[model samples]
Target: MNLKSSVGLLFFLFTALAKAQTDTTRIKSYADQVMVRMNLDTNIDQFIFTEGPEDKQLETILMTNNKTRLSFSVDYRIISATLSITPRFLPGNNDNELKGTSSYTDFRFRFFPKKFIQTVYYKNIQGFYLENMKDLFPDWKEGKDPYFQFPNLRVQSYGGSTAYVMKKDFSLKSIYTQGEWQKESRGSWVPIMDYDLSIFRNLIDGQKSKETQYSFGGSMGYFYNWVLGSKKRVNIAPNISLGAGGMFSSSWDILDDGSKANRENTEYFIFKFSAGLHIGYNTDRFLFGGKFNVNANVYNETENQSVQNNNIFGLLYIGYRFPPPKVVERNYDKVQKKIPIL
Candidate 1:
């Protein structure tokens, strides 16, 4: 071939090689992501990455630092079947309220706290709203004006709320703000008439006084109690606690997003994990309890990468009771038999 044709052929070959290299690079990157997703950990160095007949890379669609849509349950059958208890703590830092150790041991009965078999879709701002269905306002009466259509906005959030309960069974409650609580309510920040319940408490072992016990509960929560060792009067058994739930949006966002970008529908997930101390005191009518809760949680918002965490305090509260578990008492002297004729 002539020099011109040879040069042209070489150029074509080089271009093909470059394109193939680029494709290979992209594939590797994608594979690395996949592996991370499968492992559910950002630290991918734990796995060996290579290319072979039996090896291929992956793309990670989900990353889990704290919340990555995972659930864990413990069935420590032998000592206890199921129990629900929570912790109470108070944050000393001026800027935060729940900033230290927290715990919620038992709250598996309320909300029909069954086996936690339901998958509740909750978050702040948009707790539970219809999405797949068409939005339609109620029809007007004869002389009434035509009602407008429902707004197309979604504001799903998940954050713990503090409230004051005066009556039992949440007959009346006042909801507090979420993060970095403000001391003053501003008077206009009318608190909600009621809240589901508060799971944090302070175990006041001082004077005989009623240490305000907030009903320890989680919207999407459950409990599985298990006793792993021999039961004793001063029994100290290790345990685990997990609670997860989401919050709802308000009507304000509904109106705003209704007439705007219509891109405001998203959900947030909050999960709490507590592992610390569990002390149960047996009584006939009630059970005195104590828990020094240390908890860590992850807050996740849809379509966002900046997932946050908080070390919630005031999550450990005492004074929870249950049916008096039967205790067997034995005397060692009655069974001691030794030969005296030595």
Candidate 2:
């Protein structure tokens, strides 16, 4: 099926199963409160390509210049949304001179209903530079030589994941969004299915090429929340997951006459691995936390060639929870009555 059809199907399935359920003895829900948060994070989008014989192997690393991102988020009832942007003024994001100018923007929305968590997101990234310039050119100097850059390369992805928690007491929301607080320590096995459609564009020597990729995968993950402190306000959680999937890719070259040529199609198997740790301090009104995560996707391009997309990032956030304003509550109630699922 196409991207839109696939996404719509997922939405319908999740909505059919939507219900408000939680174990109050082990988890505390903030569905009645409006939570606002600010987050600072670092995002890395790097692609590594390897080719050639074992003795004379070569590798190329392409990476975006903007590494730091700022985000604002709001959570109320069953919905949570966040918007993130890479600002050049942030520390470690101002190396455009050496790495090339890049831009990144992301928007994410999530829903929590019973034991199911559904998420949808969109990402836009542009510009990339060769990060291993020294390895490629032995005599290249960091400050003296400019790295090779791809100014006309852009990538956009529309993606979503559907997940279910197997244990009723485990609070995945506490670890993911701090929308809830787990009063007791607990763990759960979560099964997740993910799907995405991505578009890549590049221009070289007055020629433009575009590629579209459709991917889907399933994974099993284990998450644990270790609540500590006298007031159960501290939590330390770690999680890991492994999965395998496949991608269908189609590419075409745009000719000067505005027609397409050199059409190609390929299919590949993909392996995915991810791990993360979260530490947070939570209170009735305030919450603060930090998380570190790493994700890698590896796929073979040819008999002797491979590609890896590796992303490693860290995030810190602070949030406050408060009662919703009267107008906001009234409007949300009216909408919830009509939708029922909310």
Give the candidate number with the greatest lDDT.
2
| Candidate 1 lDDT, 1-342, residue by residue in tens | 532353354344333332322111000011001000001111100111122232332211111111111111111111112232221222221211212221222212111111111112222110112111212233434223322211221222222333222222211100100101111111111121112321111112221111111112342211111112333222222223456655332211123223422233344465555433333433222223333323444453333333333322222222222322233111212222242110
Highest TM-score: give the candidate number: 2
List lDDT for all candidates, in order.
Answer: 0.23, 0.87
Please give, for residues 1-342, the per-residue lDDT of candidate 2 as tens digits. 532353354334333322222234477989899999999998889999999877888999999988889999999988999999987778988777877899999999999988999999999999999999999999999888889999899999999999999997888999989989998777778999999999999999989999999999988887767777999899877777789999999999999888999999999999987777789999889999998777778999898899998887789999999999999999999999899888
- The total number of steric clashes, by the backbone 3 Å criterion, in model 1 comes to 33
TM-score of each: 0.25, 0.91
Question: Per-residue lDDT for 187 in model 1?
Answer: 14
